[model samples]
Target: MDDERSAVFRFLRTEIFPGGEMPGKHDVLEYSEAGGFSVEEIELLRPHYIRTVDTWAENLRANRERAIAIQSDEVYDRYLRYLTGCAQLFRKGISNVGRFALVK
Candidate 1:
């Protein structure tokens, strides 16, 4: 539901700040290609992040379509803004995990 959507949304922001908290195992604080999670954790979280993007995109599209039928222009506009903001996450998701690709 909303919680799942929020979880995915936060990961796409590209930086950790403010709350100063993040996901990790065994008392670790962070990870990246150049940081804390180590090779295995990085490999694992990478796929999960991509999957989360795909999930969020599908849900957002579905929700927006439904909203189009009975919602105001503002709702439509907001979703469009959201779509733009999420472009990076979507592109990364598909390139990293989606099987089909179009060459151009």
Candidate 2:
């Protein structure tokens, strides 16, 4: 990821999801195995997340006045930017989302 994209992800991680951890595929696999769970499927969900964020951004724009009223313009704008950045990252493959199915 480029510096700007990394910065955007970092900002989202820190400001929006404080103390949250983004684990890699290997990390997830290892943890699941250690917990005696077998991985049945691992689905890469970047495309889905891209669509999801796009929808969120569109909804935010549609409800801009209400969002700003509920929070502030700054908060609304920040979240909009965060959603936009997330979509971009997912589309460009700079970031990814995943779903894992495990059987214990």
Candidate 3:
């Protein structure tokens, strides 16, 4: 999961920082226009995100022993609870973990 998240962040970095590791003034303008998405986009993507997390949670549940072997029982349990809770929050519209758009 962390690797997947890192990949996403790297993708964003490419969009927001083309030349170097940090954003320049021109990059900032680009970011304002195209770097970040909007709430409507987030809302549109929420269901898909929920479905993905649901699958991940279910898979984790099914492979509990392997997960425990990879990490500690406490870590495995916490991650499972987190994924489950995130799905519920997304379903209820209480939170959107992937909502990176700045509210304006």
Q: Please report the candidate that would top lDDT against the real structure.
A: 2
Could you give candidate 1's per-residue lDDT for residues 52-89 as a string of tens digits?
65566567667776777788657665655544445544
Model 1: lowest-lDDT 10 consecutive positions: 95-104
TM-score, one value per model: 0.29, 0.91, 0.53
lDDT of 2 by residue, 35-92 (tens): 9999999899998899999999999999999999999999998899889988988888
Give the whole-model CA lDDT for all candidates, comma-separated: 0.47, 0.90, 0.64
Which pairs, if any, clash in model 1? 31-37
Backbone clash total for model 3 is 0
lDDT, residue 87, candidate 2: 92
Best by TM-score: 2
Candidate 3, residue 38: how far the Cα is off, in Å: 11
Q: Local error of candidate 2 at 38, Å? A: 1.3
Question: What lDDT would candidate 3 get against the real structure?
Answer: 0.64
Query: Which wins on TM-score, candidate 2 or candidate 3?
Result: 2
lDDT of model number 2: 0.90
lDDT of 1 at 26: 27
